[model samples]
Target: MNDMAYGALLPETPREFGFFVDGAWRAGHDWFTRTSPSHDIPVTRIARCTTDDLDAAVAAARRAFENRSWAGLPGAERAGILLRTAEGLRRRRDEIAYWEVLENGKPLTQARGEIDHCIACFEVAAGAARLMHGDSFNNLGDSLLGLTLREPIGVVGLITPWNFPFLILCERVPFILASGCTLVVKPAEVTSATTLILADILAEAGLPGGVYNVVTGAGRTIGQALADHPDVDMLSFTGSTAVGRSCVHASADSNLKKLGLELGGKNPIVVFADANLHDAADAVAFGIGFNTGQCCVSSSRLIVERSVAREFETILADKMAKIRVGDPFDPQTQIGAITTQAQNDTIMGYIAQGQKEGAKLLFGGRALDLGRGHFIQPTLFSDLTPSMAVGREEIFGPVLSSFHFDTTEQAIALANDTVYGLAASLWTRDIDRALTVTRRVRAGRFWVNTIMAGGPETPIGGFKQSGWGRESGLLGVEEYTQVKSVHIETGGRTHWIAS
Candidate 1:
């Protein structure tokens, strides 16, 4: 890593890479460049693949799946490869983190933390490979036996977003492979380096040829191709609800493939009057400030008890103001650059709209020109109505909108008011209140007394328009599998016609 002033890091030169297909690097007729969001310099040149290239990658995945080169391997053998991949990731932790920072524009420390979480995904998936099992029925008499088998769902198409690219990929890849499925990935064009690097690491870890392939290009061309490809047996997508809906349409228009989507969120964090205001305030700040509030599970909406709303808002504002917004290379920087120019503009638009809607700007709302690179100071808006654009839509930036509730029931209502149900969190010392809110919040994942807590051991997905199916944990592995029932007879069956 090359060092700069203020403890920032940069690459000596822009790294060049090709698409990975059929266990080999393939060049494209055209190329696209990804500039570092935090430095405004070209950091990587990725192959610009077309629909034909997508077909090739999908064909390779289909071939690999049909041939069963990886699927035929014993569970222990598959687990061995996943473990090796985990080890390889561990070895290249820092290098990968550097690339992640350059491509995704997240703080170095936060990127490193995501790498650790990714490593755990692989490790857990390795264990799951050996432990995942189908069901057998012994209830039938000696004359007959029944069984239910879980088999890989052929070729899988994975489309990941730019935010948390590597983490989202790792969250699905190992588990899909564990279930004996082959995959072709379409990573977000701006953040393709880590996904391609992961392909190399998997190959180094002895993953079979064509078992894991990566294709890069614009989402409209290559990404939609993956979703529409009939050979793809399943499509797992993580992005905005609009795109996720399109993926569903592509599936319905094509093969009606199994879909797993983790889309947008207007997640809420409710704090009761009796709750620890200090702790709740810290969590509220961290929840929205983390990843610059570009998280699907970010607690963007804060619904505090009316009595303590003013006090809690003050504490949260102080914490949000203290968040270090600086270079991605700065280990102490809690907030980094916006991942893309368009997203920055979108966030700014939301900030403007919030003001237009009469929401009070409690803290930072202006864009920061940090010498070079797109940066936004951590922002908070109070006195927000649920009808405001910032309050309703997924801003996906370092912005928090505040709301107040006079009762627990109102808090629950405010939390469940969004079209999304990806995640929700609440702070309360009373067990009854916590239990009630957790059960009635209408989110797939709920956190009580904490925020953004959990591991790969738990499943993650959404309800309603937030999308369907789950990822991670044992269910993550099963998500890529299809179940079939089998029946066997111990005694010879008598023919009805003959009788």
Candidate 2:
């Protein structure tokens, strides 16, 4: 890779932003500027909020939930607001994508697709608001009636990570609102712009003041505050597994608020000998290359049948080599800069460790310099054992480790060997083999012949350490709600005491 000129996509000046609270933008005690990860230029200046600010936001959400300003609305009205917000997102998709690319270091094309996915999330949530229902027992005695009611759990706290900032936020927001819960969101400080901008969209769409709030700052302060706040009824966090454990501890120490977490993953991509080599190779390339491999659900492990292992590795390496890695603004660039310097160093460290641990470097192991900003070539390692650190840990970069299995049983066992079970992909032309592997693999989301497939229509979560609860689809709306069983006498009241 050679030096590439920074294009006009770089903002000449940093855009100033304020935290949203009670339907208004408020200044913090301090402020900080965020530099674009790809261009290495100041992109946005954000308020540096503190725990007190988080408290204010939580209080506002609590008030809104108690007053029913948003919760009191009819299902049709809430759905209408969500639909309008979706339209607003469509209107500003380009601008949002630009900000996403600059701050997150993902390609412009991928960011645009994320915006579209966000829109679909809102749309699906709107339908769920209308269609979501509880159950009634009609078989009870004539004088007795039994019904189960699904009600909003109350104030919800949402903590989102830097990777897929707006996408993850939208995946939960509309659904939380649809469940009639007020929420306070704490987006990753590095990528808070889009989440803050969403405040305006929701307000313009007729959402009540205090119904939704955002506090921007470091996670240790604000995020911990959300977890410990007694008034918060639920907390949904998306980030690393270590932090997810901290969240669990905080919840237990505090109110034990309902927790919804989408945590870390060392997902696997298994390819059988009977699979289409071309399609499997392509999907494997996309699985590790997408988002520069920063995604939690990214398939970092390649488990292929030993018979086709050499051939498949060759095809996959060729595909990875041809992927364009350059400026995020460049439409032709398939892979962009690493999101942060720390992540870049981490990936490089893993590359070194793989070699030191005796795994053969099949393809890339060097970093690329494109003028400025951090970038690494798509990496692949072969002869990887299940015990290798690179094979077990989540490197969270454009790195793929390969393992060979002689039989389907070995492939399935290798895939399930990891503690993290976020997702897995199986490539096989044989339906029986696909179904068998899919059943045995201990992953939450499984794809046959594809990787990272489907949309907001289906539910997604982890199996073991991947995190608790689902985030999308009809189940998404229900996650923020609690169930209450109600019993009534239709004709006469039955007294336990003799009267």
Candidate 3:
């Protein structure tokens, strides 16, 4: 392979761009230029989907489902197709990685790792198809037989975010297809190229036309139409809490379809006095700064024990200072450019809010100078309180807010005080203390002595306002299927008495 292709394996770029719909490449109504945040240059121009385009895509998905091209396929056959797609993704890992880096503005190394994770998601979903078995209860009461079966929910509308576009799409689509459902995916306009390219890979892997569709456009237009489309059986979305709420409201106008939303989070990392300071610092850094803190499950709030708070802040600031920030294509860069200029402005606004809230800015508080790219310094704040907007809200940027707590009880209280309960991390050596905090923290995923460590085996979702339903693992497969109970009377008949 040439160096470009080889680097593609490590996260580079695709040779060309196109949108995949009904297993074919079709030009959209208009094109929108995607600019590289690291270089401030046009990466590629993608199809700017219109409302009519979304209607067409959803109609195609509905036809594919009604015709049973996917839903009627045998589980084993569907499983084989998904497995083949996973294999195809593995073979072109470098290409996918490169496309991800170019489109998503994540560091090359992180983009490559995300590509591997995406492959793993498909593989796991493929295997999960066989495990989608139901229960058969014979002879429940001498003459009655009962059986429970699972079937796919037709025509899933998958709306993914820009931060981890490929990973999020894999998390939703593979499982939906594995459960024998067709999908109409609308990736974020700013980062739709990688997903559209994957559509080509899936088509090559033998996914039937209309079984999977990609519609690219801004959320206000195409996204809203998809959510409100009466034909879509379910909607799976991952983005900001405000938009998630809008989706929920819009769904109410349609069929009130099954919804899965992974929304915003101001996830907390509570470090106790007994915690390993060095390890805590490193884990906290990864939690908040990974993906430039654009992740929904980011541990943005640090509730540290007052006894070790000062020292932990020092360690964290020193660590933040060392993160290499630059171009997304640079292998040595740890933090890549922000995804867009608007996102950069949003993050900077939050940094200013942190200062206005009286939180002490410890270190790294300004946007970086990486040519004309959208780069922000990894920021850390001290003297943060639970009542402050910086501590309560989801910034979705590379900003960390540290709150001091005097006791473990106080730490747990502060951690659970937010409207979001997506994920949280606890750093302590005591096993019993970890268990105690785990029980009290109202999050879907909890980490002890670690932060954001998992593979496809772990199920991911949120609690309360973090949104409903689960994704990944066997539970993820269940999300796409509906359960029905069949009851039969062999020797007896039931009668109702008149009142």
Candidate 4:
């Protein structure tokens, strides 16, 4: 995973890799192969870990935590290792970015940008570690003093999704490490390639044995095992809301492990008549088109002021027409392959549902045969009502449902109509409207004039079924720690002690 070795993988064809556990790379009981979504051919054969592997990885993490090998470290010491991890990621940025193209099919340029963001995530989490402090108060009697301490929450289990494998791991793992919690990671089986590389990156950066471990396999197996293990103190997962519900249930059925789920989002992008039409259109395109709109925060809903709806649709269609959809290895490919054939089918079903519901098809809306992998064109639906299945459900693809509103209140209503509340972007030149609209939007991240804004410094999660708990920033670090209170008697020992 070192930068010098990056060149070796760029001509990157299918390669076989093993899981990393207890600071050692090991093969699984069986194996699973993942095909390159762009090439529609096998590109990776990964270890399919069984229950025994899960036990071993989690046991290692438990030993590390209980031994205080990592949890007992001072904030500065933990921060140092986290910083090293960040540096390690920076060094291997190129190779890892390219691997993402092969494994996840994000465009090379976007993958590179995501790698940069990953580095920032570690750096920011490192900063948050230094800021992990508790408060002191003396509201009691003069002889009494109160203090609080933030302690690492013991071993944590992480299950990340494939849509942005590197991105989600960077978002979760750094904070967990910075909080001094040992972890057992179960990245999505379809895209475990870069995560395996990350295992090497972390170990090379000097993370102690058992302090960080990775297991690859089906989520129902390794992921469920991690969730059910009594030793795991917390579980952080990123995926669909249905799967998120299952995570919650597993936690409840097990030791009631603390759960942090960053789940599904049918996010909305609102445009006002006063906004710059072209700029709004471009932002909408980027929002839905990024990662082929596989992101939880993808703006699948476009609610525009009626006066600007027709014009905005025209501009967005033009932008979609200009997008390049082809091989992921090509740096110019704006939209690469969908993560799997099943996912492509699901998206197509949603498009057909839109058509059946009488929504107008403004632009693209069909599966493309690029002669290799799962590819879908950027799609748009017009005159969609809030109640349409396409507008209400999480398609998790490059599909946008278009709606219109005559007033700001109506626009807000349209945006808030979904079950999801992960993110929303508002476009308006009016400062009052921008502030008001963004504030009123029920989303974890609210963007004004700009869509998909924010970085590692900002916290992201969701409201309602989008899932709970924040990731990134100081809030993220807090999710991995438990607070304990201590009181001391400074004046004199009370007679009640003897009594």
Q: For residues 145-177, could you state the per-residue lDDT of candidate 1 as single tens digits?
A: 899999999999999999999999999999999
**Order of models, best TM-score first:** 1, 2, 4, 3
Q: All candidates' TM-scores?
A: 0.98, 0.98, 0.95, 0.96
Full candidate order by lDDT, most accurate first: 1, 2, 4, 3
lDDT of 3 by residue, 1-499 (tens): 3233213432233234566678788876688888777666566678887878778888888888888988887778888888899888888887777667777789888987887888888888888987898888975987888999998988899999999989899888888888888899999988887888788889988988999999988888988988999999999999888999988888898898989999889899999999889999999988888999999988899999998899999999989888888777767888888898888998999899889989999988899886667889999988876678877888889899998889778988989988999999999989898999999999999999988989887799999899889999989999989999999778645668654
Cα misplacement distance, residue 146 of candidate 4 (Å): 0.3
Residues 365-449 of candidate 4: C-alpha lDDT, one tens digit per residue: 9888876678999999998766799888999999998899999999888888878899999988899888888788899999988
Q: Which residue pairs collide, candidate 3?
A: 8-94, 9-94, 11-97, 11-98, 12-98
Off by over 4 Å in 4: 1-13, 497-499
Clashes of 4: 0
Report the C-alpha lDDT of model 2 over 311-349, residue by residue, as the tens digit: 999999998889999888888988998988888999999
Q: Give the worst 10-residue stretch by lDDT in candidate 3.
A: 2-11
lDDT score, residue 203, model 3? 90
